[model samples]
Target: MTEFQILVVAAAFIVAGIAKGAIGIGLPPIAVGIMTLAVPLDDALAIMAIPTLTTNVWQAIYGRGLLRLFRRFWTLALTATIALVVVAATLGKLGSAQASAWLGVMLVVYSTIALLAWRPRVSRQTERWMNPLMGIASGAVAGITGIAAVPFLPYMQSLDINKDDLVQALGILFIFLIGALTFALFRQGAFDTANTIGGLAAIVPTSIGVWLGQKSRDALSPEMFRRVFLIGLLGLGLHMARGLL
Candidate 1:
């Protein structure tokens, strides 16, 4: 990576870190979305994988009863992993342009839902089947677009879990999907050594940003900030999709 790309990569991760720190999620979507402006979509995703995985590992373990939650959501994890690998190996081969377009679509769709706060509740009776089924769709989207914030986030939010448990659940799900994504990208030769090193280098800035964001979380209204951030991403997504038009 050139110096410019390196700087962009660091900045992207830092911003992603802030978002995640404040809201307990959003690291991958922000990091990869920003990096795609200065690098290829594959490179952006590769550079994002390590930071995302590391942060989510912490998020996954910080809460109580991780094992219990994992057991409850294991089906979601398994199906998501399988779908990620298969879809990435298949549709992810459609090249950068198609992937970029898909990324934009996901970002726009996710942002719209978040902005509207239109969450459809999933009752306990239907969750058993819905979890695994949604996992397939979520993983397919994450695989092709390298953004795992759509169906998965929404589905999880719709469940009856409390705030803290919801955070841990998302973390566990991300670990599985992102791990699968990393392997798939490597198998496809999209995540090479340069991307790996770049991703490693991003950890510092990402850490600092998260720390700062966590500090600010006490002072700022996270909901308001999230709205602003989502709006920015909505615009970025639209810009990326313009080529497809």
Candidate 2:
């Protein structure tokens, strides 16, 4: 990678980290979306591997409810994780442009949902089936777009779970999801020297951004930040959506 590309990735991770620190989400999309402006989608996803794995692992265990969440959502996690691998095995099927378009659609869907504060309701009876279904769908989407927060998040939001528990649940699920993504990328031979270095270099800035964002939480309104983030995501999604056109 050129020096400029490295700097772009580092800046992206730092910004992503700040958003994650402030909101407990936004790292992957924010980082990948920005990095794609200067790098390829495959390279951006490759560079994100380390930071995503480390952060998700930390967040999952921090709540001290890993076991409980895992037990409850094991089916969803397992199916989604497996589906990620299975779908990514066909990595040859998608060109970079197609993946970018998919990412754009996902961002649009996710941002629209969040912006409107729309969430579905899931009863315990329906969850027995919906769980695995959502998992399969979520995994497929992540496999292609390298973004994991879309359908999975919305499905999780629909369930009767506490906020804290939900956060931990994401940690557990991403452990499987990100792990699968990384492994899949390797199997597809997507990793390279520069991408590996980029992933490693990202860790520091991401940490700093998260720290700064956490500190700013007291002074900033999460609601307002969320709105702004969604709007930006919407615009970025639209930009990427041009690939579909």
Candidate 3:
């Protein structure tokens, strides 16, 4: 890869990291969009997967009091996510552009639903079933579009799981989803020398972007953070839509 390409990938990673740090999501859509501008869609997807997995793993492991939470939900969540990966691998060759378009639509729909009545308040009697059901939905979405956060977000919000647990759960889910997708990509021979190097090179700038995001998070008020995150979703959704057009 050229020096320019390396710079682009690194920049994407930094942005992705910051997104993860601040909102606990947005890394894949944000990073993949930026990387796609620098490289092919497939390569961009591959590049983002590594860092997505890496950072989330760190968050899941190091975030305070995650182990007990993991033990509680791991079975249902992991199983469903794996099932989704199997389905995704079977269909991934349909084309990355198609996947992007579908993802864009899903994101817009989910975000709209989220914004309309963003706070999901579940009754006590129905709460027990929420996790497994959302797990299946999340896994299915992840399998299809490689973006699983939407399904789980509302469920997580409804429960109002503590912030730390929420972050850890997201981290764990991302790691499993990414890990499965990576294996599928490998089996399909998606990784080549150029893309591998490109992915690694992109990590530098991506990390920088993360740092910048973190700094901004410290300065932003709650309302400001929500607004910024929404704007980001719109921007990324449009970017993905462009691939379809």
Candidate 4:
């Protein structure tokens, strides 16, 4: 990668990380868009797999005790993640453009539904079934486009989980998805020398962004953050759609 490209990827990482840290999501869509400007989409996807996984793992395990949560949702999370990995692996070699276009459409549709609905409620009994079902759907999206936030968002919100638990659950879910994607990408030979180096270079900025985001989290209310994130998703979806079309 050129010096300029490295700088761009690093900057993208920092921004993506901050967003992920503060909002508990947005890294893959945000970072992938930025990175694609500097590198191939597949390489960007490959490089992003690890950092995304790293941040989610940190979110899942950082302050929240894992044992308590793990026992509760491990089955749902693992099943969803694994399902996506299998789907993604099956679609190997289609390249990232088609995936990006599909991702763009999904984001726009999902974000639109989320933004319009208020007080969306689901019963606990429904959640039990929805969890795995959403996981299967999310896995399919994540595998195809590397963006799985859409399917999981509504379910997460309906649970009325506190901010910390929401973030933690998202982090755990993302870690599983990213880990699966990393392995799938490797098996598909998505990583090359340049992309590998570029992905590694992004780690520093991404970590810094995460730190900054965590610090800023308390200043904003969860509702406000959610609104902003949804808006951001809308904008990203539009931008991606325009590019794809």
Candidate 5:
């Protein structure tokens, strides 16, 4: 790989890690988006697997409510995992640009809802049916577009969970998503030695960025930060939506 490509990947991870540290999200989209500017989409996706998995595992397990979240959302997790694998295997047959457009739509809808504070509260009885449905939708989305943040993140936020648990729950969800994504990529033969090494090298910058972002998260109000993050997602969605135009 060229030095320039290496630098871009490193920078992407640092930026993404910082976002993850602060918001418990953004790593995959930011890293893949930036890395794809210099690397092939497949290579970029391959490189993201390990770092994404390791970090989210840490995030998921760091909090006290891991078991509770796992029990409550296991259906969503299981469905997303199975659906993603199926989608990933068929991704070659599906038009990737079309998938991305759908993701763009999802991001726009989620960001709009968040900004408006239009919470569609899910009743306990309703959650049982809805959670698995959300899992299928998000899993299919992630399998196609390599983004699991759209309906999944927004849906999780609407649940009656506390702030810290929300963050941790996102971590748990990402763990499943990234793991499934990695498996799919492997099955598709996307990884090569160079990019694999690059992925490992990316861990350092990502860690540094995550540390900085975590410090910032401690200092800032999560609610305010999340609001700003949603606005950013809105802009990202518009950019992504241009693929359809």
Candidate 6:
């Protein structure tokens, strides 16, 4: 990568890390979304795989009752993984423009839902079947767009889990999703040595940004921060979607 590309990647990840640190999620969406402005979708996705995997691994293990939660959500994990691999192996051939458009759609949809704070409660009875089904759908989106946020985040948030558990569960799900995505991208030859090294290099700025965000989380208003973040995403989404035209 050129110096300019490196700087762009660093800046994007720093912002993504801050969001993740502040809210316990959002690293991939922010990182990939912003990086796409400077790099191709495949390159952005390749660069994100390692950093996202490592960070979320930490997030997943930090909380209690993981085994129990994993057992409950294993179907979701399995279904998402399988679907993601298939989509990556197939639709990944459509090239950057298509993938970028798909990503734009996902970001806009997710941002809109987040901005509205419209929480749809999923009944316990519905959740029994919904988890795996949603996994399939989310995996397809992730495979095509290199993001697993949309329905996955919303679905998890709708659960009855406590704050800490919810955070950890999100980490676990991301770990699974990102891990699978890494393999899928590799199968498509997306991760070259340079991109992998770039991903590692990004960890430094990302960590710094996250630390700053964590420190500021107490002082800032979460609602305000989230609103601003979503609005930015909405704009980025529109910019990305224009590629399709």
Pairing residues by index, what is the TM-score of model 4?
0.86
- Shift of residue 188 alpha carbon in model 1, Å: 0.4
**lDDT string, candidate 6, 1-245, tens digits:** 88888899999998888888787778888999999888888889989988898898888899786897798788899999999989888876523788889789889999998888888888768888999999999999898888998799989989877898888888888889999998988888888889889999888988987997787688897667777778999999988888678
Candidate 2 Cα deviation (angstroms), residue 172: 0.9
lDDT of 3 by residue, 12-55 (tens): 77766777556666788767666656666667777777777767
Query: Can you write out model 4's per-residue Cα lDDT over 1-245, one digit (the tens) per residue?
Result: 78887887887898788777686677887788677667766787888876777677778887655777666567668777788778977876324777777766777877787678744777767777777787887777778877676667666777856777777777777777787777778888888887877677677889998788777787776456657767877777777677566
* Candidate 3 wrongly placed segments (more than 4 Å): 1-7, 113-117, 123-127, 242-245
Candidate 3 matches the true fold with a TM-score of 0.85
Q: Which 10 consecutive positions of candidate 2 have the poorest summed lDDT? A: 88-97
How many residue pairs clash in model 4?
A: 0
State the lDDT of candidate 1 residue by residue for 1-245, as single tens digits. Answer: 88898889888888888888887777888888889888998888888888888888988999796999999899999999998889888875523788888788888888889889998999877899998999899888887887778799988999988999998888888899889988988888886789889988888989988997798788999997788889988998888777678
Q: List the residue pairs that clash in candidate 5.
A: none
Q: What lDDT tens digits, residue by residue, belong to model 2 across residues 149-219?
A: 88888888889888999888888888898888888888877799988988988899999988978887778
Give all candidate RMSDs, comma-separated: 1.2, 1.4, 2.7, 2.6, 2.5, 1.1
For model 3, the run of ten residues with the poorest summed lDDT: 221-230
> What lDDT does model 2 reach?
0.86
> lDDT per model, in order?
0.86, 0.86, 0.69, 0.75, 0.81, 0.86
Better of 1 and 4 by lDDT: 1
Pull out the clashing pairs in model 4. none
